[model samples]
Target chain A: MSAPAQERPHLLRIGDLARATGKSSRAIHLYEELGLLQPATRSSGGFRLYEPGAVERMRWIDLLHGLGFSLQEMRGVLENWWSSEQGPAAMEELRVLFQRKLEETRESIRRHRDLERELMEGLAYLETCRACATPAAPVKGCVHCTQDHGMKEEPALVAGIMTSPEPGHRSGRGSFVRVEDIG
Target chain B: MSAPAQERPHLLRIGDLARATGKSSRAIHLYEELGLLQPATRSSGGFRLYEPGAVERMRWIDLLHGLGFSLQEMRGVLENWWSSEQGPAAMEELRVLFQRKLEETRESIRRHRDLERELMEGLAYLETCRACATPAAPVKGCVHCTQDHGMKEEPALVAGIMTSPEPGHRSGRGSFVRVEDIG
Candidate 1:
């Protein structure tokens, strides 16, 4: 007679774990080597066997890794979760790590936004050509037609943007490309 | 009588350009090789000669590079500035590059914000410990005080955060921090 349905064993091999989790076998092996994971059991043939939960564990590793956590840092967070330490101490250590990561993420976002502003300015300067019905090609072409038709507000504008402090602003610097710097 | 100070030339050599711009000589040479900069003149001895304006040009190149433009791309942009075909075509092309870069920057900022939220939630869970008049040491020290009285929001909260999108959302896929997988 077949085993009871609920008691049926749905074991997976190491290869299955890698394929199912969309990770490489090498990565799975590396995780095990790092002590971040352990095979659920070893078959009589000495092959590593895993439960369904192994896939989920791999995913958590990928998630934290994407968030910029290194393997060592992730190991620390994960190990603490199951460590005999269950409350205050565990939470405090994780809080420090999370806070530091949050700040780093914020700083990166700020830099991205600044780059965005600079690109926007470059785009705007190019837009000035909109007033020109039939513009020249670009490099030496436009200068011949427009010469210097009173369209240069670079130094002063740059200075203003540099000194101003918007909300959520930090001591970070500025970009906002110069008008003369682009097409 | 010798030439007046103002009448004296302000020509600089390669070493002088490096010192003036705070760039490595190799970098300055690379910029020249990339056509992003040019020596104002060349001495009879084959030394590179640069005008004071070369320093300003070097600064612009540095700024644009910092804004994420490749040396090759910057060369293309600067070259177009003085191109004989300067006009509608040049402006349109630069606009496209700038606009694409802008969108990419916006997307990065969005991702950063999402990460910020996730990190904030992790932090909030940690803060929950503050309510425990006496949090355990941290790692292996908290269970004795309160085994599971009311310390389970972390998993559920993390799950909720993973599933929700506050605003300005797009279908950029997802992160792998599922709730059922971690503590």
Candidate 2:
């Protein structure tokens, strides 16, 4: 009785674990092969069996993966968990991972937003130009005039906002702008 | 004289143009192929000759490309400028493009910031855990408890982020803490 309890702590078949975790059986096998996860016991026919608690650990691994942690990183974290007595260090590591993921997500959202804005502006400009056949007269003495605007100084509001190139091309002299210099 | 001015525009050889733009000849040729730029004239021997103004246009193209506009997108913007007589429409399109680029830059910055945050958090968590050998008491409640306090509730975010599976496994069920009824 003692041997059976030790070998099989609520033994679970591979299929049962896969369904509970929403992972394919093939993936489960692969994880086992990788040594990331191990089964608690083997059946008479040589089927893998897991303890009920394995599901929780698997979920944690999945969450970390989703947050963009590499397998190596995950291993490092897991090793930390396994080797060290459970304490503040493990919790702290988990927190750090969370913070990194949050930052990445925010950045992605910001980039998409920028793209959307550019498309809108381009479309709007096209529509306006279509309506007006003539180039707007170069505004005289206007700080924003493309010709008068120098790279040295910019209005505070427009600083780091946008970059505009010189009005016309001059042969032999290439006029190029750096996108980063723009706002 | 007028015909010559229109025909050649004081053509500069490709080498000189490349020197002026601080770009490699290969890159210049690639740009030409992409239709982001062109030489104003061709030599009798089929050499490319750039007019004085070609350099500036190339510079602008380079800048826009760095700003994340694809070659095709740059071409569209340039076409509006070169072909359209209506200045207003062209200006409008430019405005739109600028707006879009700005947003994209912003987003990139944001993601980087988020990543930084997450990394720091992970590092801190690791440090704390390392320093303290005791495991923090497992929080009460269901599996979702940890997730509720941590991950964001955005499906779009979930879809966009790429994650690698656990190590040593081709596939494995990912563990996640479902904080709530996040669909």
Candidate 3:
């Protein structure tokens, strides 16, 4: 009942393309201005039209942005590819670029994982405070807590919140003293 | 002989604190301007001085920045803590904040971990291209590779580079065709 796949006229007007890609028309125009995108043709009413493939291209651009490539850098990447004298050279350059990004991504994961653990431990330490016997104690009292939550030392994330270095003490290590020791 | 621990004058001038914390003096001043930091006192010469604990505070601020807290939000956090009528109320508010941040951090880790895998798989796919038989082949030939490097399908990251959707095809799924099918 429907037209065959090869017989379909699949051009999308700019608005349709923007909606398909979940990007604003302004963003699509910016991509066009940057030479990162192009219209496949124009409609009879003078509206720009794009191939459905433009959606995939827009998504590819977004993925590269997520991977930390600036628009200018992405433009440079395309230029580098097209201008390369041979396929192997372009492929080698891309391989190196991807390799560096992978290393950076791994390092970012490491840092976030470390913070994840810190937040978990800090939350566990705070759980004991919910049933505090001295809920009325001054907030500053937390630095030198005497209520005996039974932890040997405060988690650094929580300790950072509750303590300041004692005035007139030169020791860099002084700030990390146990909450009980401070008390 | 070294001065007795109790008798030491441990105040650090702004420049010394900046060097110790690896922050510029301007950054320390900006933190002060934002009311997120303060001087412990002023030296006789009118230079700002800080307690050694200020270093720990600066590090804490950096950690918070890493966790995506802006300076204004950090100021609000301090205000919330001090304005609380009781310690338990303050701790409860902080507990909620940390719980949300922990969730966000976990999400960030998941996204980055996904990207890490994509890059690794993309790199592995590229490895086969290193010894490409037709190093002199037009770069576009990669989209419908005929050399039989033995990949069943292109990784999305790599396919994204090689192909554009064929014009006049309405299928959203048309862009992801295998290399052999496209050829």
Candidate 4:
């Protein structure tokens, strides 16, 4: 009974846009409220309709979010660029921001990589304990373990758990290696 | 004059413990409140004192925190292990927990690595745009760039920025490749 979509200017309803973009309606509304998104027009029934370009706009927002920009910060980025008179100057500011973010990302990766190595070493050590023969071994005995763990030193992760209270300086026995010492 | 540290049972005051552990006094208090930590005793003036082993315990807490356990969850882990009858069973639970965390850490590393690549590719593409000759060129013209950027295809990070609203299918010009399409 109505006109074809092609003849009527192909606009997407809000639900359709949300489905296509994999964003919740509430999230789309928040983006609209934050000035990150705009509707192309309102329908005869007062429903919001979006242009096809809005899908690409959503992708832009997501990319910025993944790069650790808050919505408020993203608005600031847009406002600063649009308000500036020179395009090259605005772009240079963006370049500096991107460079700083890149450094932060690299640092994060480095820290996580260290953590990954620690975890792998910890797992390898734990695998040896799976067939632990001494069920009757006192829990405290793990601190001074004599059974060869087949490694030069205990991993920091396991050492942290087995660290026992040190004896006084007068005592002759050697102290258990603390986690910090291993590091 | 106050007695020497060695003569006074060698306990650490809260301030000394915080300094040694690199945690705030408030964070230590929270750990104590959550049953994840405990003070060995109180001074005559009501100040908290900790045993030397607390330093190693703090390291354990940091290791678990780095592995993504919430303070409450850590409390649960301790309770479960301490309450169990068998040593091997408790160690087995810990082994499983460590294995799961290793997988999660690897996955996180993969995602961050991807982000790092995207950032590098984006920075590379933007380098080509830094020396644009057409300061007078319309801002929208970037979406359909005629300049040869030396890359076979645009990176998703840059493509997301340069995407423009499409003309009708009848207009016959080739469409800009979207970020998701490249992905």
**Number of the top TM-score candidate:** 3
Stronger candidate by TM-score (1 vs 3): 3
Ranking by DockQ: 3, 1, 4, 2
TM-scores of chain A across the candidates, in order, are 0.59, 0.53, 0.75, 0.73
User: Model 1, residue B10: what's the lDDT?
Assistant: 66
lDDT tens readout by residue for model 1, B11-71? 6777877888899989977776666676554555455566666666776666666556798
- In candidate 4 the C-alpha lDDT for residue A105 amounts to 81
Top candidate, metric lDDT: 3
Candidate 2 overall lDDT versus native: 0.52
Candidate 3 lDDT over B89-176, as tens digits, reads 7888889999999999999999998888888887887788888988887676666676655668766666656555322222232233
TM-score of chain B of 4: 0.77
| Predicted structure 1, TM vs. truth | 0.59
Per-prediction TM-score, please?
A: 0.59, 0.43, 0.80, 0.77
DockQ, cand. 2: 0.12
On residues A74-128, what C-alpha lDDT tens digit does candidate 2 reach at each position? 5666555444443454455555556666667666556556555544544443344
- Model 2 per-residue lDDT tens digits across residues B132-173: 422454311111223332335322222112121223333344
Query: What is the Cα-based lDDT of residue A108 in candidate 3?
Result: 93
The 10 consecutive residues of candidate 4 chain A with the worst lDDT sum are A166-175
- DockQ values, each candidate: 0.21, 0.12, 0.27, 0.20
- Colliding pairs, model 3: none
Ranking by TM-score: 3, 4, 1, 2
Across A102-129, the per-residue lDDT of candidate 4 in tens digits comes to 8988887888788889888888887887
Deviation of model 4 at A108, angstroms: 1.3
TM-score of chain B of 3: 0.79
Instruction: Compose the digit string of candidate 1's lDDT tens values, residues A54-111.
Output: 6657766776775787877666666555563545655666678778888888888877
